[model samples]
Target: MDTSRLLRTTGTVLAAAGLLLSGCTTSGSAQRASASAGGATGSGAAHAAPAVPEEPSAALRPYYAQKLRWRECGVPGFECATMKAPLDYAHPSSGQDVELAVARKKATGPGKRLGSLVVNPGGPGGSGIGYLQAYAGIGYPAQVRARYDMVSIDPRGVARSSPVECLTGPRMDAYTQVDQTPDDAAEQAKLVEAFKEFAAGCQERSRRVLPHVSTVEAARDLDLLRGVLGDEKLTYVGASYGTLLGATYADLFPGRAGRLVLDGAMDPTRSAIDLNRDQTAGFETAFRSFARDCAKQAECPLGRGNTDQVAQRLRDFFRTLDAKPVPTGEPARPLGEALATTGVIAALYDESAWPQLREAITQAMDGDGAGLLSLADSYYEREPDGSYANLMYANAAVNCLDQPPAFTGPAAVTAAVPSFEKASPVFGAGFAWASLNCAYWPAKATGTAHRLEAKGAPPIVVVGTTRDPATPYKWAQGLAGQLDSGVLLTYDGDGHTAYGRGSDCIDTAINRYLLEGTTPAAGKKC
Candidate 1:
């Protein structure tokens, strides 16, 4: 999913993850629905296939051998560090470099200290350091934390690094509220302008680092990180879009790849259009699951009826909102179809948030859009002062760089609508239009839709939630199948990711893989 048009997550915050999707709209994140609670933000894939050599050339040897300067930062138990990476790996002699921010929580002793366990909670744009401090550092199982140091890095062009800045908060607010499911040319034009403005803002404010923020480069940084940490290989756990980063790293540095767990994986073989369409279907699948559970409850705000009927009614409500927006307590921000839909998509990242969704829907239906509006704010990671995090800006930068635009223009979106709707009746059109944001991107793509074989890597465990709203389960299957040593661990469950969401089976399998290096038997189902 293009993080610009599609807001998404890692298995989210046990509150913090998941993104929003809208056509031509500068949508906010779809982050990691953390196996515990987070969603992957952007989706990534490469095509044809780039030739990746096993080792860096001698010019880059200095980077691979550079040391990190660690210091105590604001976070309590966490120490921060900075590492220098070539601004352009292909041109090491350019005399320019990017300084990456990193964080770590040293392992709690008792057992012999294992190597660093680096984690990424997706967002192609997500702040890995934020996630490490917010959850992974303290929230992970104690047994695992006792031996391995919890570490993370804010990828280039993301938070704390040289970030990609686009619109101001007020402008973003207007952009997010733009009618995404356009009804006519005028509406479509409004959407198009929003995307154009967003793309222009990126080029104007962040042209320097924007072109260099591809997943392939970020993966290379991981190898540099591995060397700096003094680890023989990279020990890692990545969720949502993080999986794509991890997969890319494994494919590029198969020899340096250590124990890796890619939860809620993305299939690198799909084209950009296919990825957007797949995620539309993924969100629809999750909505059906939510509807089924809602049907059994008397408090269901969507009323009774089957999933299709309820989905139709929900569509009707959105149309109603399209005609008239509702109040959200904040005078400037109202609950319109775009925000309401984003709110719904955000909740779908995790089933635990269903009750909140139900209540929010009920409130919206009652004309008080506050509940749903709050959900949208959370999805966008909007702070109280109306300032925004750099998540959305970096999301578009990385996503557009990873693959060519999914749709080139409004005409292309119109042509693809039927195929997209065939994949998802509820979200097809919006997502198809959403896929167009990249068409306005300033940078040329450095990657394409291709396979990630990681031929010489050790066993890499891939986890999939049966009803993930952002990354479909089929992607997990596809990724595991492509890798020479990929093992698929299936969790017949809800939410965006499979680990840390109270599944002892999923957690145990991953824990063993990271700890004792025990790879679960192929096709293990939890």
Candidate 2:
């Protein structure tokens, strides 16, 4: 579990690989793999396939006290809602409602409304409603926007929806600064204490909400939203951890699935350990890409050389920081391994951030760590005023409830060190050990990893970026393979999710699917 650790590890590996491959121009073969055909034809072809529903569940009641008053928020014609779900689905009649923030932008065209289009921007902890209001609600292709009402809901225990808050502002500051790559017994003990403190904080501050934030419950909440939205079936687009949420929905309500798109998919079958190690490898892959690109640039920090050597140099730099943090202008300005690692992971979310990461690295190399530190802060969603978002707290709560921790003790982490380092020579060791944080989670896991067949579901499009850092490409491959009606769309390039990261081919394909109800061909790459 520990989805944050999983995401962080995944991001690190993909970032490392991306850094290494930055110098090499994408091959024609790669381009072929990345481009896929799009349009209403694909959607029609997919819908013609047989329906499959592996699991069926009862519908959820509307939790709103009064009908929503639809009004504009940020985007033109967008309306927002504040719905409610049970703190625990199994105990829905318990009278305890967890608020779920939602947003909608109605169709804008001459055609009859096809249905509601639900969207989620990963994080297991990311604010779906916020993302909808900020980007997807307005930025999604106009064709898709014209046919369907765009909708988003913040999952339980996430932002603006009865969020799970753990540490206070100052406590969180200390938690973020805790050294992640411990070099000595003292440091290791400190790390363990940090985990304990974090868990304890959640138990103390958000006890009633912590145990019920599992992905399964959130998936159930999605189905409830589907019912309330008056859609006969669910049409959704979820990215990163959002992919996991979508897949879970399919598993739980396969009969209701319709035109689901899971981008940057997460593999539900993988154990916490497997997820962590694989992610380590992914970051190494990304680092190599970045390193290769950096080698050819004038501001290259690791210099022109083999990617492996450059990775080692970066590792060495991390070690140096672990020993003596670098100054960054704040009260506790020096950057430690945790903050540095967070900064590195943030850039892995998008290829467009590669140049900024390079500049951050160059500055850090020259004893100026502010830029990189700032990137880390942004990734952590830490505010400039020293306040913090509830993201990390919610992330930990949900992840802890999804799966058991990979390691229970520092000794186990120590034992796994070599494997972690070998998985990703650049980021393996740190990420491998970071997986242990959830070992001390106050609440026990309430769910287990399982395949999402969605046998009776309509054809679902699963998109994956070959070098996606957060949710590895293999996850998309695995999820598509798992779903009975799944169709795979591959993007043979670097980034987190494919739809809006700047590939016209990708945007076109997804747009065509949403607008026309088509599905991209299996193995189609974009």
Candidate 3:
């Protein structure tokens, strides 16, 4: 597979898991308007409102004034709301409103309510509200849930709100198949063409929405939500890319910070290129862990040997697929490097998925690519009916807007390939180059890399998994170090984030903090 396709696949998977839950809804229009007008007076009373710079445009003023009415939704204890935010923060008066989907499950315990606890599953584009309703809202420790009203909001350009859609199902299907690791000049040209096509499609389909769907803008919009939620201080738990969003919020509104927990944290100081390279190396580390475990298993494909050799073998398989893809169950859809890499990347997120990855690879080696393809399909969030979610589009838009592209073109990618290869030997070159996708983005970035230092914020917890691949453990260390009042909690294990992925020690530490305003030691390791 070519680099672009790999990026599209990875971006798609991350975005889908990140923001799949929230979306725009038409049913709550009247309620939204009434809530906004009714609650405007008390919205800023929870906390000292940040200075509203100048008069906001009439268009954005209404959204800022809007109050979210927590009405009963599908979940038994949770209430949902639809709020509005400005499309462009710079031109807040533009009158172009983007909807934000929100959900909250009220506390059930007898203790006095501490406040709302907002949570996010990272993807720069992840749906905060969706995660709250699906997992965190109901599954969080009963003790923590008892003291806080669990809350979440779908950021701009994400699902359950006004989503930033770029392509139709058919167009996205075609986009996903484009190769990323081109072998020759012709293949390289094909890769460039694929990027152009994807960019052009997004531009044509989402011209109005693309430019405004940036992380910085999303952070500002979050402040608006914080105000509307009537919280004196913003309490949040963010994972993966959500960490970046949370940190951004702290940077933009330090005074509003409350009990924040950033799990599977991201380092805001790294450049896009550096972040990508580090992530590539992290994946290699995770793959080595998988290889070590697989070699002990009876069904090991690469056999019992050095992990380096297993990695090389996997690379060789990818090279072979680059030349000729194998047949999957679907006749028109052959399993190529992009799909194979995606399958591997999916497993790297959680060690629990390692066994499944081993089985998938063993099946692929046996000429049945169905298992691997299924893993890849799950990562991409591909529906059984040949439809796709809008995750990739939103991910690209948010990532591209958060920082500039790592590389400008194929030449830059070629130069970086060797270094990338050195990082992972298996996924390095491809992932390294995959970081360049934003170079062809249709919109300019609205944010830049900057350190987050929430100096006046209350004690915040930052969790790190020692062997996390998606968001490396070092990122957690860095983010914790950067935050003025950050308390580091380490989970000496494998996985993307640490809160609910079955670590009793880790969960207890976080729950204690959330329920009683107690923080773990600065460097407590589980």
Among these predictions, the greatest TM-score belongs to 1
Writing each residue's lDDT as its tens digit, candidate 1 over 152-227 gives 9998998898889999999989988887778889988988999999999999999899877877778778888998
Model 3, span 189-266: residue lDDT tens: 877777777778778877888876665566667778777887777888877777776776775567777778888777
lDDT string for model 2 (1-526, tens) is 1124434212212223321111000001111111111001111111112222333323233452235656666666778877777775545556888878889988888688899999877666677776776677777777788888989988888888888988888888788888777779998999899889989999998988887777767776787788778788899988777777787777657778888888877777777777777777777777777788878888778778889777778888888887877888886657877788778777765666778888888888788888788777766667778887777887878777677677889999999989988878777777866788889998876444556676777888898888876667887788789888989899889766777766888888887788777777767886
Q: How far is candidate 1 from the true structure (C-alpha RMSD, Å)?
A: 5.8
lDDT of 1: 0.79
The window of 10 residues in a row where model 3 has the poorest summed lDDT is 21-30
TM-score to native of every candidate shown: 0.92, 0.88, 0.88
TM-score of decoy 1: 0.92
What's the lDDT for all of these models? 0.79, 0.71, 0.70
RMSD of 2: 8.9
